[model samples]
Target: MSRAAFYDQIETTLDQMRETGLWKPERLITSPQGARVQVDGAGEVLNFCANNYLGLADHPALVAAGTEAMGEYGYGMASVRFICGTLDAHRTLERAIADFLHTEDSITFAACFDANGAVFEPLLGADDAIVSDSLNHASIIDGVRLCKARRYRYETRNLADLDRQVAAARKERPGQVLIVTDGVFSMDGFVADLGPICEVADRYDALVMVDDCHATGFIGPGGRGTPALHGVEDRVDIVTSTLGKALGGGMGGFVAARQPLIDLLRQRARPYLFSNALAPALVGGAIEGLRLIAEGDDLRNRLEANAARFRSAMTDAGFTLTGEGHPIIPVMLGDADLAGRFAVRLLAEGVYATAFSFPVVPNGTARIRTQMNADHTDADLDVAVAAFTKVGQELGVVS
Candidate 1:
């Protein structure tokens, strides 16, 4: 109980969080993860809180592949890739990701969290510099911090701020500069304009990397990613994304890039050196998921259609959404308390969604973030949208 002198402050802060409407308690799930889920004490609930954009988690073919791999390779690796954990399936998944991303080579990690953790430091040093977007995912921020490189942050996708930042870097600390950004900003559903960013990077002779966690499966032709959508797939040198998002809803991540960068990460990334490799069954399932994308992404097409329908209806209903054309839709409520209340009311109406507030998002810009999946039918979206409309008006968020 007395592990640290600051223990009482932890309880004190938690109490404060409850008072401020920031304290969250997770609910128990009584059914499988899918388009609709059952809560322990509640009835059937439409899932809008998950990152399962492709709805591939419960596909029969993926399940079959996973089960077969389990039979072929057992349960766990029990060791890191440096040891006996580097199975043929793991290497195959890596290669599969490279082919999907149109990159030269790739590497696998336990999660995209670790892929970013292992990426920066091994590739850059104190003498080098990292120029990152202000609103990049926390993983990339932590990765840059773990490295000794000088850090520079540009305003999120603002060309003026980007130029200002680049100018500052060139004027003050001239070295090998690297630019980092998310292919799609998860919170706002805004895609990075990689064409212009690449032009800027080329001007500065800086390396370019994108974290394509949110855009990998529905952003470009055949869902290549934001870079491909922006017509600069060849300009992005490295990309990191999760299999758990659009590919498979299990747990795995990957880094795809040229052969030299891949070789360097394999040789020196700390997380790669220390962590247990991905489970063989999951790796095999991810390989199958990639194969499906290349063969024909009916899932991706359905997801786009769903996003368009929901966004159009929500906007017509007087609900404001962030940027257009992405499955991640943010319903702005402005007050953290109200957003939380709105989420509860929607849940009671059998629609499951989560509210974002301070630290996760800006304090006054609180919102209920809804993610669409390929499996959500027209009727399902209409039902969810009706729930939102009702709750929104009752809460004064619309009309």
Candidate 2:
């Protein structure tokens, strides 16, 4: 095809997306990430779509630490870690992450997507097998595709299906069998059944990897993540998580595992070896973020209360909601166009929430995924509930 033909084809796809209400528009935020933010066109609105679960995105301590680190180490690493990029603060952040996750060691990456991409290829060969949850994140799916490992898939969060898949995998007598899942599925807010997943792994002598990008820094005891929440910290073999969410709401990711596994990743993980080292400022902020998370029981409690309050109020107001006992609560709208319209109405009502449609969630299971954070107060919850109820009624999603 000619270049102009290719461009026309892309334009056709874009037009189709707009006609079908699948075109997601990006909003401009004019302030730091928090429960309330100044948006360019919408003015200041209550933000319920952020991953800043612990409300530490703009915390004073993290800012101070980042500033101090910038003064000491300058801004960027300018090189990969094995070259001239490894800073002492980088080592400190890695150790802090390993300690937080209760792992032997950890290695950093530019993003959790990179961390997940770096994981499978270096460890699993063509003779090995990877049994992944059907609902695992796209990062995991892409990572699996990058590796030459034999692939098996189980139904989402179904231990019985996992057992069957693992048994099938063992029939191949592969060199290794690795089971992978997301600690929390983002669109539906469903937490994975990790305890049972660990059991299946043990039964088959398979290694287990969890992408805890959504759960780290807020889901488990002391915000250690799904493994600690399920009491499977020692059972799970590998954990990949992000700093862009609850951990200071900055950018970086890491893999926490056994010392030898980390050592091997350092040498062979393509993303880590090829990507720039995480900035010293982010590392210092993450180090402080870990410290705050460790002593953040009160923050966790408030976050739970806010989520519960919002979930209960919304349900009582005649709205369907998904997930339980976690900050992520999806207000189910079913139709993609309706979901998009609901979000637009919510924004106009002073609530900032986004719609999850096909490609993010199943076609008929579209929703506005609302997330609660420690920074949101009862008043904020009340305002959000009121906004949702108003929009819900206007859209006939509720009585």
Candidate 3:
């Protein structure tokens, strides 16, 4: 096709998206992540958006650690891990992550995106079976798509459907099967009912895997993660998560599991073998992030308290939010135009929450996904709630 033909097709799609209010305009962030953030041109805004769940994105401790790592280990590891890249700090960070999750061993990746992509093909063959939650993150879906395993997707959080998938898999595939799900659904903040899923996995002699990207450093008793929350800490076989979001808030990913699996991933996973190693600074910062989250009951507890307050206030104000007690709260708006308009209005009123509509979520399940942080005080939360109520009622989304 000619360059003009390709350009014309993209322009036509962009126009279509604009007509349906689905085009996403990127925002320019001017400040480091925190409760009060400065957007590119906007003044300081009350930021209810961002994945800084524990409010540790720009913490002094993390900053010191990263800065110190630069002096100790230098900046970037120019080579892949297997070739003159893995350092003592890399080994220590992997051990710290494994210890934190109470797993046998752990392996690092460029990002959790790479971690998920690394696992699917190497572990599961065409003869095996994979049963996945339909609401799994895009990374998980893509990983599964790349695998040769016979794949099956079940309803989101419907334990009964998971059981059905397992039963069908056992009847057909007879042996190797993996049950995959996200620890918490990012779009709706809904937690996976891992206990029941564990039961089904156990009954069907299937292995369990979870992408803990959203749940780690925020959920569970001491931020031990989703399996810990469900009393299945040791029941899960594989756990994958990103350091980009909650952990370091910089960039990196890891997969924790039994020593054998970690060893195998290190040996065979393409990303670990091909991609440039994580920056020394990020690895160092992540080590400290884990330490802080371990001793961070004060910060993590405050985040939960904030999420509870927001969920309760929104419910009392006649809004339906889909999620458990996790901090990733989605304020359901239902219409794409309404969500976009609501986000723009919230920005105008100094609140920084984004709208999730078609594609990022199911069509008609548009929402204002608000995240809570330990740094957000009750007064700031009140401001957010009142602004939401005002805009919601103005939009006639609430009575």
> Which of 1 and 3 is the better model by lDDT?
3
Looking at candidate 3, what is the lDDT of residue 262? Answer: 91
- Show the lowest summed lDDT stretch of 10 residues, model 2: 167-176
lDDT of 2 at 119: 97
How well does candidate 1 score on lDDT at residue 264?
Answer: 92
Give me the candidate number with maximum TM-score. Answer: 2
Indicate whether candidate 2 or candidate 3 has the larger lDDT.
2
| Residue 394's lDDT in candidate 2 | 88
Candidate 2 lDDT over residue span 169-275, tens digit each: 98895589999999998878889989988888899899999999999988888888999999999999999999999998899989999999999999999999888
Off by over 4 Å in 3: none
Clashes of 3: 0
Query: Each model's TM-score?
Result: 0.97, 0.98, 0.97
For each candidate, the alpha-carbon lDDT, in order, equals 0.88, 0.92, 0.90
lDDT, candidate 3, equals 0.90
Residue 355 alpha-carbon offset, candidate 2, angstroms: 0.8
Instruction: Count backbone overlaps in model 2.
Output: 0
